[model samples]
Target: MTLETEFRTRAFEDVRRALLERREIALLDVREEDPHARSHPLFAANLPLSKLELEVPLRLPRRSVPIVVLDDGEGLAQRAALRFTELGYTDVALLAGGVRGWAAAGGELFQDVNAPSKAFGELVESERHTPALDAQEVQALLASDANMVVFDARRFDEYQTMNIPGSISVPGAELVLRAQQLAPDPTTHIIVNCAGRTRSIIGTQSLINAGVPNPVTALRNGTIGWTLAGLELAHGSTRRFSPATDGAVRVAAAAAARAVADRAEVGRTTRDEARRWADEAVRTIYRFDVRTPHEYESSHVPGFRSAPGGQLVQETDMFAPVRGARVILADSDGVRANMTASWLAQMNVEVYVIDGLTPADFTEEGVAPPARNAVTPPASDEISPAELSALLQSPGTVVLDFTASANYVKQHIPGAWWTLRAQLADALPKLPPAQRYVVTCWTSALARFAAPELAELTGKPVQVLTGGTSAWLAAGLPLETGETQLASPRIDRYRRPYEGTDNAREAMNAYLEWEYGLVAQLSRDGTHGFHVI
Candidate 1:
C-alpha cells in the first residue's frame, strides 16, 4: 500500500475498544496546551507538534507502537503524522474528525490536563474509601497537643509556595522511604496533604498498603479545604523530611515496601532481563530511574531517564503514552522503586522494580539530553547575549519571547513581547511591524525552531538569542516582569482553581465538586483499565 493509503483515520469507537482491552496505544493531541485543555478524550496525551522531536522518543519508546494523532481541525494531525513518519514511527494514524470527531462518535471529552490520572485518583478514593479527616477535626487536633504531624505530599517547590501552617515537606514516594526517620514512634498520628486531594490520598493509602504501624489519615480536600475553613497558610516554609540514617530503619522500611509491592503483583527483574527487554524490537520498554532529580543526575544506570517516582505515578500518562507498554523502574534504595511500582500495578500497568541494585551500579553521570530525531545547529543569524542587548535599543528591532507565559511573567528581557510558537501565524498580525526579529525561549532550543518559522512568516531577518533568556540572566542584563506586552495570547497553561491564594471561594468549591464526581464520570466513560489493589 502507498504511504497515503497506510495513514488511515482511526475511529473513536475502535480506540475505545483498544483502551478497554488494555492494549498498547498512544492517543496524542498534537496541539498547544491551552487549546488541548479545552477538550480531548480521556486517554489523549498532549504532545504539541512544536516539541514532537524533543519529547517523543523517550515518551513513545518503540517506534511500532500504534499511535493515533488528533487535532481540532487545524490540520496539525496530518502534519504531525507525517513528522512521525519522518521520525521512523512505523504505525501512525489520524483520529477521524479530530476532537469534534470523537464527540460525534459519542466519546466523552474531558477538560484540564492530567485528566486520566486525576480520574483514576478519584476512582481509587471512592472504592477504597480512604480514611480522611475534615478540616475542622484537623484544626482541633492541631490546637491540642495530639502528637500528630502533617506531611505535605507535593514537590518541595510547591510546598515552598504555600502549605498548611505546620506541615513538613515529604513528597509522595518519599513518604514510604522516609517514614522510619519522620515517624519512628508507631503511635504517632500522621496526616498527609497536597495542593488538592490526589497526592494526599495516594500518599496515605501508600502507607496503609505498606502496613505501617502508624494511625494515618488524608487531610480531606487537602490545602483547598484548609483555605475554605478560614485558616491561614504558611509561605516560604523550608521544613523537609531528612534522609534515613539508621540502617535498621532503612532495612525495615525497604522490607515493608517490598511486601506491599509483592501483594500488588509487581514483578521484579534483573539488569540482564532489563537489557534484553530494551533490545526487543516489537515491545516498548520505558527504562526510568525513579529517584530524586539530584540523585539521578549524580549517578544512575545508563539508558535510564530520570523520572522521580511520585511525579511518575501521578503523571504516568505523560511519561508513558502507550497504555500497556512495559515500564521498568530503577532506584538504588529499595523503598522508592518498590513503592512506586505498586501504584502502577494497581493502575493496571505492567510495572517492575529493579532487583538487587547498589551504589556501584550507578555508572552514568549528569542529566541525559532528551532523545531527538532531529537537531538543527545554530545557523548564520545567531546573536550573542551582548549583541541582543545592543540590538534591543535600536528602533528596527523587536524581540519575541517564546517561553511559557509563567516564565515570561517571572523574568524576561525588557521590551520582549511574550509569544507562543504554535500561535505565531495568528500572532504575527498582532505584532508591530519591524525590520528585524530576534526569537528566544528558556534555552534557545525552542527558539531555534521558532526562528525559521518567524523569518518565513514575516519575510524579515530573524536572529536567535544565542542561549535564550537564560543566557541574558547570566550576563547580568536588565529584565522586566509581569504579564505585559503579549504579542500572542497566554494560552500555554490552564490555571487551576486550587493553585495560588487568590482564587474565588466558589471556584475552589466547584473544583472539589468536579473531582468528587470523577468516579461517576469514569463509570460513564468506561475505558479506564483501573482497579483497587
Candidate 2:
C-alpha cells in the first residue's frame, strides 16, 4: 500500500467524517506547542515540524495510515507534507483550511495540550460519577488530625512544584499499586490531586474501580481549586511513595487491576501474541512500558518505550496519535499496565496488556532509543565547541540557537540569537547578515539535522556547533542568559494554565469551565468513540 503521492488537501468535513467512522487518521498539528495550545481540532496531535523526523516513526508507525498535517497559516503544512514524503509516509494530506479554517467550517477547536485525554477523563467522571471532595473539604481535613492521606497523582517534579501539605507523590498509575503500602490502614481516606483535573479524576477512579477497601475521592479541580479556595501550597516537598509491599497486597492489587481491566473489556495478550500484533503491517501498534521511569530504566521489554502510565493516559494524543491504533502496554507488575489499559480501552482505543511476564523476561535495560534518526551533519560542517568559542571572538560570526525557546532563555552562547528550525527561513531575514552562520541546539541533534535546510535557504557558509549548548556548558565556557536577540517568536512551549502560582484567576476558572463542558463538546463532535466501561 505504498500510496505516497503529491500531498493533497482535506476539508474539515472529510476529516470529521473519517473520525466519526473510526477510520485510522493522524490529524497532526505541525506548529510549536504555544501556537498549538492556543487552538486545534479535538483530536489533532502536535508533532511540530521541528521534531517531525525525530518523532514520526514513534507516533505514526503505519506509513499508509491517513495523515492530515495542519498549521495556523505559518506556511508549515506544505513543508511538513514534504518531510513526511521524504520519510516514506505514504498517505499524507493537508487540512484544507488549517486551524482557523476548521473554525470557519464549524469544527470545534480546543485549547491546551492533551485535549483528547483530558476530555476522556471528563467523560469518565460524568459517566462514572467519580467521587470527589472540594478544596475546602480537603483543607478542613488537613487542618484537623483526620485519618486521611492526600496522594499527589502527578509526576514527582510536579508534586515538588506545588502540592497540598502532607500529600505524598503517588502518580496516577501508581495509586492502586502503591496505595496499600502508603496507607496500610484500610480505613484511611484517600484523596488524589493533580495540577488540574484529568489525572486526579483518573487516579481516584482508578482506586475506586480497582475495588480498593478505602474511601477514594479526587480533589476537585486539583491544585487549581485548592489555590482558588485561598489555600496555601507546599513547595519543594520531597515526599515519595513507599516501595515495599507485602505479597498479599501485591496479589490483591493484581486481582483488582485485572478485574478493572476485564470490566473495561481490555484485551489480554501474551508476549508472542503482542509481537505478532506489532509485526502486522496493516495496523499501527504502539508498545509502551507503563511502569515508572526508574523501573523502566532498570529493566523493560524490548521494543517498548518508556511512557509512564499516568502520562500516557493523560497524553494519549502525543504518545499514540493514530486515533484507532492498537496499543500494547507492558509492566512486570500486573497492576500498572492493566490499570493503564483499562483507561485506554475506555478512550475507544484497541488496547491490550501483555500478561505472564517475569523480571527475567525484561532483559533490556537503559532508556530505549528513539524510533527514528534525523539527518546527520557532514563532518566538514561540524565545528568543535573550542573552535566555536574562538570563532565567537571574531566579528561576522552569527550563531543561531535552535533549541527550545524556554531553554534558549535559560541559557545559550553569549551572543547567540534564538530561532526555530521550522521558522528559520522567516527568522533569517530578521537576523544580522554574517560571513558565517553557526547553528546549535541543546544537544545539537536538531541543529545538525537542520544544517542542510539552513544551508539551502541561506546559500551561505553554514556550520554546526558540535555537542550544541550542552557541550559548551560541559566545556566550562561562559554562556549568556535571558531572552535577548531572539530571531523568532517564543512559541515553542505552551504555558499551561494550571502550572505555577502566577496564573490569573480568570484563566484558571476558564480552564476548569472548559473541562466542565468537554463532555458536551465531545458529544457535538460525534467522534471520540469513548465509553465509560
Candidate 3:
C-alpha cells in the first residue's frame, strides 16, 4: 500500500508548539520497555513496535488523534509512520530525533512510571525550595524543639530493618495514597528519608505534587548521610505490631516465605537465637537486612547484609542456596519484614525477622531463643562464600550487581559488574556455564536470594557476599566508586560498534526498543507484581 500520510522530517517546532498550546499530541515512544523504564520523555505514552496494533487502538481512542513515533537511534520511526498511516492514522508523524532529540532539548526524562529521575531532579532543585535537615540536623531540630514528623520513604522492608531512629516507611509511590495514614494534624512539619537521595526526593516531592498542606523536606542524602555523620541506627529485636493485629498472621506470612526458601516448617529467630546461627561456621547463615539499597549501603547489621525486599522475593534461591538452610531477616519496619517473611514461608523455607536489636543488643544477648521446630535438614549442598571466592580467583568469574543503576554507579564492591535487576533473569543465559558466577549487591539480602538462584539456574558455583559490600569495606578491602557507569548499548552506544553483520545496527536498535518496553511486556508475564526497589 502506498503511504497516504506525508512524513514531517522537521517536526520539532510542531511538537514544541503542540506542547505549549496544550494541543493533544500523543508523543508515542516506539522504544521497548527496558530502556523506557530506564528513561523516557516525560509526557510520552509508550507505543512499542510489537504492540503498535494493540496499544494504538486502546490509547488513541479518537481515530484522527495526532501521534508521534520514536525509536532508539533507528529509522524504525519511518516504518512505524507508514504502519500508522496504513492503519488509518492520518495525523501520525515521526518525532524528529525521536527520544534523543527530546533529551537533547533538555526535556526531563522519567525512569519508570514512578520516575526516580524526575523525583531526583526535583529533589536536587528542592534543596533551595524546602528546609531540609540531615540526621544530625534533625536531631538538633528535635533538641531545639522543632516539631517534625519523620517519614521513611523506603520500602517497608528497609524501614523495619533499620531506619533513621523514628522514621516510618511511607514510600514515594505510596505517598499520595498513604499521606493521610500519617499526620492527624496537617500542620506538622514533615521530613522524609530513604536509604539515600532518590526515594526521599521523590517521596517528599510527591507530597508537594499532590498539594498536601504540609511543609515537607527530605533528609539530606538520606540515611547514608545520616550514618556518615556518626548517628545511631536502630533495629527492633521483636517486631512491634498493632495489638489488634494477630501474631498468627505474621507466622502465616513467614510460613509463605519459608515455602519460597523450599522449607516445610519455618521457625522464628531472636537476637540471641540468630547469633547462634551466625556463630556456626559450618552453617553459613547469611543475614540480610531486607531494606532499600541506600539504607543497606549506609549502615546495616554488623554481620547482616542488604537484600532488597522485592528482589529477595523474586530471586530467593540465588541468595540462600543451602536450598532449605536457615535464612534470617531483619528490618527496621515490622510490615516489610513480615511481608517478606510471609513470602519466604510460602516458599517453604526457614526464615525469621530480628526485632528491636542494635549491634549492642546482639552483643548483650547471647545466641538462644525458645525452642519451636526441630526439622533442621542435613547439610545443604550449597557452596559457601569462601568456596565461591576461591572460584572467583580463577578465570572467568562473572559478578553481577543487581541493584539500581545510580547506586551501582556510585559505589559497589571491587570487581563486581553492573546488571539491571529487570534484565538479571535474561542476562544469566549469556554467561558461559563454565565460569564461576557471583551475584552480589550492596548488602546480603539481594545476594542472599539472588546468588543461590544464579547457582541453581546457571549451575555455576554462585556465591553471595556473606556480609555484602559493607563487610568488604570493614575488612579493609578496596571498593570501586566513580561516575563511570557500566557501559550498555542503552547507556553508551559508541562503545558497541556496528560491524556490517546481518544488520547488526538494526538488530541492536530493535533489541533496545524491546528493552525499553520490557517492564510493560513483563506485565504480560502474568507475574501479578512489579519491581519494588
Candidate 4:
C-alpha cells in the first residue's frame, strides 16, 4: 500500500522560526548571477538553478537536511523541486511566493554571505572599495599603522610593468596555496584588490573557501574605483623583490647536500659511475629519457622509457615510493631532469640526473649535454624501440606513454596509458602491480624521469620502453594509436578504500552535537566509536 503525502507550504516567518528553533535548514536562493550579486539575503546562499546540482551539494550539511528552495517571481521553484527529487535528494521543500513573498512578509535580504558583512560595510563606508583613498584617511591610517599589508592580485609580469605603490603581487590561483606563506599571523587583516571587480570577487572568495581565518575584504570596483576617487596608481618597469631569506635557506641546503654526498661517499658521479649504473644489471639502474610520449616512440636508449619530468616529480611516490630506491633522471635539455632530481633530493630520494648524450660518447663535466642530433636522436638520451618491444612482451610489464593530451588522442601504442606528469601524484595510488612497466615519452629524458616512478607505484620488476613508441616502430613492431581503448586493470583509476581515520573529524563533530543535543545523532550511543582530542 502507498501512502499519499501532503505538501507543506512554508512561509517566511515559519522558516525564520525553524532557524531560531535550531532546526536544520538550508535557505537556498535560486537566481541568475547578476541579480544575485546586486542584492540577496545576508545568509542566503545563491545556488543558481543552472549550477544548483554542482553548488548545492557542496553547501549543504547533508542531503536529508531540509532545503528551502526559492526564486524571484520566475515560477522556477516547482521545476527546481522536481529536479532535486529526480537527482535523488530527499526533503527538498518549496518556498511559497519566492523572494517577493519573503519581501512582502518583511524578511530581510543580504548582499553577500561569503564576505563578513560588518567588515565589508566598514570598507564600503570608508570608500576603500573605491579606486582612490582620501588623503585624510590615508594619512590617519598610515600614521596609526605601519604594518598593514596591501596586496595586488595580478600577474607578476604585469605588476612589474605597472602597479599600485607598496602593493604585493600574487596571482589568483596562487592565493589559497600561498596564503600562509604571505601572512603568518592569523590576526593580520588582508585587503585584496585587482584592476577589476571580477578577479577581486573571485580572489576574495577563494580565500574564504580555503578556510583562511584572517579577515579578507575586497576593494570594491578595484583600482578603477580608486582612480575615480582621484587616487594615484603607480607605474614601474623594474622588478620588485619581496623579503630576503637572510642566506639561511641556501646555506642550509648546501650544507645538507654536502653532508649527504659525503656520507654516501659519492661525489658528483664521474662518467665511469654513470656508465656503470647503466650497464650494471640487465634491468638494474633503469634509465628513463624524459620527453613527450610521441618523441619517445620515435626512438631512444635501447632500454630507456619515456617519462615526462613534470609527471615524474609530482608522482614521486607513485614512481618510486620505495625508500632509498635508485633512480636516474634524463631530459633533452638535461636542465629539467637535473632540476627535478634536485627537488627529489630534498625528499631524501636517491635520484641522479643523466645526460644520456647517446649510446656512444657519454660526456664528463664541462661538456655540454649533447645537442639534439637531427640525424640521430636530438641531444637527449632515450630508449630504443626494440628494447621497448621486448619489455612490453615480458610478463608483468607496465607501459606508459607520457605525451600531451592532444598528441595522445591522435595516436598511441596499444596497452599504453597516457599520464599527465602533473597528475601522477594523484593517479598512481590506483595503478596495479601485476606486471613490470616501460614508460615512454616523445624523448628518453622524460622516460628516464617517469619509468622508475611507474616501478615505485607497484614495487614490481620494471623496465622502460626505451626510445618510446618510435623505438617500437623502428623495430617494425605494430602500433595501436587513436584507439581510445578502455583503461586496463593495470592502469585504470584506483579508488582509495574509506578508513575510519578519514572521517574522524566528521565523527567528532557528530559526537559533540549528539552530546549537546543540538543536532540529532546519526546513530544511538557511540556506535560510531568516535572520540575527540
Which is the leading candidate under lDDT? 2
Estimate, for each residue in 1-533, the C-alpha lDDT of model 1 and write its tens digit. 32354478899989999888878899999898878987899889999887776678778878889999999998788878987887788889999999999999988888777888788888888888899998889999999979889999888998999999889999898898887678879999999999888898999999998888999999999989998998888999999987545788778888999998999899999887898898875778898998888888899998798888888888888888888789999988798899999999988899998898778889999997656434444464899999988877778899999888999999999989888777788888877779999988888888887888788888999998888999999999999999888987777777777665365688789888878888887888888878888
In model 2, what lDDT does residue 490 have? 82
Please give each candidate's TM-score: 0.95, 0.96, 0.36, 0.33
Model 1, residue 484: displacement in angstroms? 2.1
Best by TM-score: 2
Ranked by TM-score, the better of candidates 1 and 2 is: 2
Model 2: lDDT of residue 338: 96
The CA lDDT of each predicted structure is 0.86, 0.88, 0.54, 0.48
Model 2 lowest lDDT segment of ten? 371-380
Clashes (backbone N, CA, C under 3 Å), per candidate, total 0, 0, 79, 71
RMSD of each: 2.3, 2.4, 19.4, 22.9
Poorest lDDT segment (10 consecutive residues) of candidate 1: 371-380
Of candidates 4 and 1, the better by lDDT: 1
lDDT of 4 at 100: 75
